[model samples]
Target: MDYMVIPDFVERKGSLYLRSDHMNYSRATLNSNWHQAREAEPKNYDINVFPKPPGRNLHTATYERIGHLKSKGLPNTTTKSALEQISLKPDFTERETRKSMVDVASFGHAIIDRELDAPSRGFGAVLPRHHPDYDKLHLETTHKADFTPPYPYDPAPERPPDFPDNSKAHRRYQSQFTDTADYRRSGRNTWQDESGVYGNTEDKRTVFPRTNPIPERLVQGLK
Candidate 1:
C-alpha cells in the first residue's frame, strides 16, 4: 500500500488535544488525542518513505543517534528512552521533536533540552549524559500547543454584591455606618486617609470599612 503520513498539526480544546500521528510510519492517523492514542500499538515505517517535513527531517548526525539508540537496544516504542534518544538528536529542533513526541503520545513528564544531573518530577524524556551539548541543556516545561497567558492584574470593584438583603440588622448597620459626621469628614479630606478606604468620588462608593458579610451571627454579635 502507498501509505500516507499525517502532518504535524495540533488542535486543542479544553483538556483534550487532537494531534497528528507520530509512529514513525506512513500509515497516516489524524486527530488522535493523547488520552486515547497512548494505549495503541507502536508503529514502524520506512525512514526513507516518510516525507521528512521541512524542519523534522533527520540529518546525518541525528540518524547516527537513532542508529546508536537502536544498537543500545532502545526499541522504537513510546518508552522514555526512545523519546529521549529522539530529543537528544541534532536533526530535529527542540520544538519540532516535542511536537513529534506529542503526536506519538510520547510526551512523557517533560522534555529535557539541556543537562539534567538529576531527574525532574513529571518529566519523561531526559537529555543524554554522553551528548556533546549536554552542558548547554536545561529543563523546559511541556505545555499544550495553544497554552494561554495568565490574566492581567485586576483589582476588585468597589461596589460589591455583599449587602443584598434589607434586614433589621442591615438597616441598623447602614444607618450607623453611612453618611455620618466622620464619613463626611473622611469624604471631604480623602487625601488625609492615604489608605484609600473611603475611595475616590469617581465610583461614588465608600470602599472603606469593607463590608464583611456574617449575617448568621449579625444580631448576636451586635448585641
Candidate 2:
C-alpha cells in the first residue's frame, strides 16, 4: 500500500472522484490485506508499493501514454486522472483493464506509494500478504526463515530510524496512480479549461477528458 486516494468530502462529482487507481491486489487478497493492516498497526508494521518493471499489457501502454502526454506540457496527467475523467474507476470496473489492455501512458508503480497501514503514523505490524508476489513490508532488512516474500528482491534500502526489525516482511509492489484530474482535485479550475490552456486548441486537448479520448486523438501532441 503506497497511498490511499480518498476524495475530499466536499469535492464535486468530478473532483470528489478525486479518483484513485484500484488497489492492484486481488479482491480476496485485498480483503485479507486490509484485515492484516488493521490488526498489525500497533506493532510497527507498514505496507508499501514500488514501481513494477515495464513492458507488460495495459500497464505499459498507460505508462507510455503518460510519457507522451508529459512532453507536451501536460502538467498533471496521470493514470488515475485519465481513468476517472472517463468514469472508469479501476476499482469500479467489472474486470480490471490493466491486465488485458496495453497501457503505457500512466505510472504503474514507479512514481507513487500508498500508505497501507492506517492510524499510527501510517505504519502497521504483522502485515498480511494478499498475493504471493506482493511484499508485506518494505525490504530494508534480510528476511528471517519465517518471512515469506519471494527471494532475490532488492536486499538493501536505507532503513527508516523508527522501523523495527528492518521491515523484512513488507516488499513494495507496483503503483497505479497518476496526476490526471480525477485522481487529484486540487487544481482542476486552473488547468481544466478544456477549450485550451495555452490558448491553443491542440494543447488544451492535452488535458485528460471525461471519457476515453486517447484513441479519439483528442490531444494530438500530448507527451
lDDT of 2 by residue, 111-216 (tens): 5455645542324534544565466666655556558677577768897888544232243222223323454445436354333223233333344235663764
* Model 1 alpha-carbon drift over 4 Å, by segment: 1-214, 220-223
lDDT of 1 by residue, 111-166 (tens): 74656665643355353344456588555556643464576567776766785432
N/CA/C clash count, model 2: 48
Best by lDDT: 1
lDDT value for model 1: 0.46
Count steric clashes of candidate 1.
Answer: 8
lDDT values, one for every candidate: 0.46, 0.43
